[model samples]
Target: PEVIYLAGIIDRTPSSIAMRLVNFASVDPFHQNRGIAGLSGGKKQVEPIWKEFIDNKEDLLFESEKILAEKESVSIDKKFAHMLIGIENLVGESKTREVKVRVNQSVFRQIVLANYSSKCAISGIDVPELLVASHIIPWSKNEKERLNPENGICLSSMYDKAFDKGLIGLKLDHSIVISEKLRSNRIKPYYKQFFAPLEKLKIASPQKYLPKPEFLEYHLDVVFMK
Candidate 1:
């Protein structure tokens, strides 16, 4: 998530990312001795395979709990503070800034995936690593929908970025709408090649919480570039 939100790379959920970390730990040479025994079982294996984990359960549990909290979507307050600090050099990042809200990213993802069937609304990319929960209404614009899953859509990274930049948007009928700028030859060839064809393509319909028409309208009128 640090890589995802902060750096905008490696589009994956916390759980999928956690598994990758576990795989890396298995081969990490520095922690070889401390690492759990590999599959094929330890030599002579007198103790149970789960012994190490069982014995350290309390310590591991505590650490896992910390990770879980971190995995949850950041509180809206923390998110705002972080953004403000980056943009305005906010010192101490104001924990008391009345807008202290946290966003549980995992929960948000779950809700978005539930709505969009765990795939990009435009491209239908099923690979979890390439997907993001995009807000139909910009996060800063709608405080109430900051963590509201109904306000989110599962979009691939490219589409997400384009949508955020107002280069593209969803029509009232849920089709993709490419902005006129992207259609200009002045734009890169790839921009026209990639986005031009998406115009009027109906996005995958959400199963449950269809994005509120007002939110879509807000994006179209306020956020989308004409």
Candidate 2:
């Protein structure tokens, strides 16, 4: 029933629906390209649809990245592209949906990295290998908003742990806000040295990914552990 309900809102066909699902799963364009192209060519009509979706989806993704850098929302068409991703989930029995979600997810990470200069947005620590573009909103919680760049943050291993734990959080204004619970004598000096300085840290100047306040609120209430 839910899938049928989901199908009503789907604007694209089943194959395209599958493609979008696949795109968000891995976040790798090269992989997605290979997978999308692997489908049988005898289905000529689907080809055009797939091609259009690929082009439009890439365009929309890049546009979203640009807006994230600018700390703004994508233009209307671009926004529609994102909104239309739901169609991918309803595409009959096709595998494209699974692959699309993966590819797009990879792209999302790259966008977040570039936007934050491959560094932790809060601590200014630059360690590409150890950093992750962590989601402000967990992926399982909101399917419609999952691909959104604004729902993510770039943080190093330690800081991500702290952020995920809610030992600290960022103000809507991007200033630092250490949870009052963490201000105790048992607090690690490392917290004082690294995270404490962050209390005054200006939210990283958004490049391609301004943090979304709505998801940030989720962090403050649920995921931030504090």
**Which candidate tops TM-score?**
1
lDDT (Cα, tens digit) per residue for candidate 1, span 67-179: 54455655434434543343343335453332223224445666798688889998889898899889888878865566665578899999999899888888778888877
For model 2, residues 19-130, the per-residue Cα lDDT tens digits are 5545443343444545544334334545455566455664566454445434433443353354345454565545344434555676777778888888888767887788
TM-score of each: 0.55, 0.54
**Which 10-residue window in model 1 sums to the lowest lDDT?**
95-104
Off by over 4 Å in 2: 1-102, 185-187
Cα-based RMSD of candidate 2:
16.2
In Å, residue 94's CA in model 1 sits off its true spot by 5.8
| Range of the 10 consecutive residues with the lowest summed lDDT in candidate 2 | 71-80
